[model samples]
Target: MDLTRTKALPIRHGKPKVLKMLLALALLLPAGFGIPAQTSYAAGISKPFPQQVDYPGMIKPSHVTQNAMNKSVSDYYDYWKATYLKHDLSSLPGGYYVKGDITGDPEGFKALGSSEGQGYGMIITVLMAGHDPNAQNIYNGLFKTARAYKSSGNPHLMGWVVADSPKAQGHFGSATDGDLDIAYSLILAHQQWGSDGAVNYLDEARTMINDGIKVSYVTTNNRLNLGDWDAKDALNTRPSDWMLSHFRAFYEVTGDAGWIQVIDNLYSVYDQFTAAYSPTTGLVSDFVVGNPPKPAPEWYLDEFKETNQYYYNASRFPLRVVMDYAFYGDPRGKAAADKITGWIKTKANGSPANIKNGYNLKGTAIGDYATAVFVAPFISAGTADSANQAWINAGWDWMKNKREDYFSDTYNLLNLLFITGNWWVPEGQAEQPIINLALNKPAVSSSIEGSGFEADKAFDGNLMSRWASNEGSDPEWIYVDLGSVQSISGVTLKWEAAYAKQYKIQVSTDSSGTPVQWTDVNSTTDGNGGVDEIDFSPHNARYVRMLGSERGTPYGYSLYEFEVYGTSSP
Candidate 1:
């Protein structure tokens, strides 16, 4: 199958007479990106308009597309909290987190505590700040839980596992991946909410990066050690432990040049591994000897029934490496991504069904299930190349009806967060797309009454408050003053038990005041209660409102929070 990749070439946007071709070129370029140049509004005078890309290519995610992606992120987080969060605050301490599957059975319930998940929990918590109002609390709990499992080997590092008194292993060695993300999430949390809060995110992030993660790096080979205890094993490294982008973050936080060496050596060793074991496919082995650069036969022999293949740990390679190419556009990273993605594209024949979950070094399919965890990374890889557009679309189509098991469900959510453009970067970084925030905005309603069920309660940043009508009323509306006319992107509504079965989201400027003339932007007939995030065509509006024509419950028209999201003009 021949793939089509339209290279994004730069052209100046100017007078249409001669530059119509250029403007057309710009539109076809990629992701609805326009070329910025001096528009001659006056004599020899010009102003700058920066071009921003909305989606993966010429296409922008429609309201339905955006809504699905956003909901997937939100819903998955909710599931993570509901399914994985085991602590009953009544019995356990306020900040202590409980990890593992929540089950009532004896054996399963006993295994429902661990230090490993706190890293993942912290990441999911901080990332969902705007959507999850209790993000900080969640992070605080996760941090406390992780701190409780501090390894005796390294006081800063967390123990690999924790369980009920009977199942506790009395182990105190840090796992590399857990600490890596735990530290990384701290950086994100610092940038997201800052160090001043109860967590002191920045200071904590530095300690974890400088003292904990940095200690795991071996000076002998300029690579990551599997754990603090793996000092003797020169080349014993897990490919998944080499978080390419996280090392860059380590450098940023510590200002250490050593981290750069590790980044350089990581690719150098990766190139060596691909050249030796899986040259054609560029498939990374789960375990490898990075310094001398070969598969770790001992680990392969002991751990795997089938050795040195892309299985559980190595499967993360595409998502990790693709991130470097996607964010920084590093050439080596791109070449590595192309190698893996190109191979998958060739084998699958443009159908996601043909792809398997696990593979051998020579590209043999070891596991046949088309699991979401494995497919998600390849879909992310496709976003890096316009050539892989067909499969990217197919991958997304596949995810629409994708099965959701325990592992697949969580990874699928993280993957959705990544591939759908909801994965946030560190704050103040350039090239961040304009986001929609609705916290603390003023909300007014036509039928709202009483302080307990007031209209403004829906915009107070608390998800618990419900704005309810005085009576079971139809055609009741809740509108928010966005303060300025901004580019409206999407709307997220947290509805109470009393929801509107049919509702329309409307927006208008109304240069003059009193009552505003509203234009319907988006409408829904099948409104599911709990939470509904909707997308609309990008339009400018200062006042955004939701009009409910039909009530689902006889009690009233009610909503916990009505959020209007938009981006500022460039």
Candidate 2:
């Protein structure tokens, strides 16, 4: 990949193009929340846009493609959207489904299949929608349902009902029922949509941590079975590995060291589960129950059932576990993710019979199945540069020109975010064309000369620059130019401010000009200072700037550096 530093655009008061992508959440819809974006603006949506090509001489392919060894990020996004979006949440028959119709219990508390689903799906849809205006509705819907649950004392928080009418009898024990997912939802609301209520929701969720921990940890099995108020035990013993993701989210929102400790401790428990749950054939058992496999490894045959309980073979855990470690920097977590990734690549990829391969990355048949195809994007996005790059090369081959199974508001938007990290989906289209960015040659305008400022040898690139914004010039600013027009998707900023009234960011195509366009992506002004993210649809511009809007501490501006992400050679 290539990255280039282009000049900035001239500042002007001209109105930046008003490009708003709509989300599917009814609550997110403005007063008269309109129909789906796909139906409302298909004609206006652009054909799949391509990343800026570093090598202009590179030939343009006519069809979509994917890597032979790994899943393509864009294809995976399309796959996720095709597999989940557009389904009527109210129609899910409890926790089960046949065809597209609800055939089983109707009163299930499954969050995605009813009015409540508007909230559940909105959580995912809003994030996936990125900077699109459509995300507003999903954000609204998410809060609406979350408020309903919170007002009801969060009965659904305990778990979702698999039947119609909110009965708790049918539920799978996955870590998703924990506070982390809720924390993510809160972050999305406040960070993405700027909902004031989101913080209160986060606080309430923080208070409920003990309850979540109790419900998740107290269970004898590794699985955290889903349920309503009184009905907690519906053992759908499938194996999943999403525990750490919840931990990562907890750490991201709370900055609590205890949470990190808790996450570190789970690795041991995970090891135990892995030993008991993994079959010699390389596939981890999806769900475990009272019955033990006859002639099972003698070590487990006698007491294995007791240990085998916490398993669910779904896309969330196997993939998200890797993502959590990669993002959170847990050494053990990284090792575990490595093992699982290897298993998926070596074992799962060998299955020629399975169309999409089994849910388990290792390809071993654990039996339980689900529609969460977001696995590909998480894996693609989180992978190490070379490895992911190769997979990206191959995955594009598979997704192009393929028909999808589950199409929904949530999954479709998410697909876009995972690959490009930008959330714009040209109207009606499922997949966007590949984007290639110009190779970047990082330049240093100035450097802080000190041994302490030296880059960590372990780090890919040493801390290029660090800033501490304080009272003197409270709102400090940092700017960078990609030097060329490219389809930029996301920006990751780090801050070390102890306290600040507010911090804001602005972006533009002009270098010397004012930021005519700004997005309030996050805050480092108050609370725990850490990394923040701003995601936008792939846009053509070069100049980027981040500055403090308020001074919480006596120090002027507290900034580490700005890390820009895009599809280009570096």
lDDT of each: 0.63, 0.36
Model 1, which residues run further than 4 Å from truth? 1-64, 89-92, 95-98, 101-110, 165-170, 298-301, 400-403, 427-570
Mind giving the per-residue lDDT tens digits that candidate 1 earns over 1-570? Answer: 000000110111111121000000000112222323434322111111111123333122233466566675576667767876655543236544545442111223244444545666677676677666666677787787677667656778876654544233334556677788788888887777656667776677767877777766454666777666667336767777777766666655554434545666688888888998899998887778655587765334244433366876677778788766554445567788788888988888778778787788878887766777678777777777677777777887776456555445555666666666655444221122234355666778887646678888777644324688756667888888877677887887767667789999888877664336888899999885746767788878878888888888776777756767666741
- Model 2 CA lDDT for position 172: 26
Model 1 lowest lDDT segment of ten = 19-28
Question: Per-residue error at 38 for model 2, in Å?
Answer: 25
Candidate 2 weakest lDDT stretch, 10 residues: 1-10
lDDT of 1: 0.63
Number of backbone clashes in candidate 1: 2
Estimated TM-score per prediction?
0.61, 0.45
What is the Å distance of residue 352 in model 1 from its true position?
Answer: 1.8
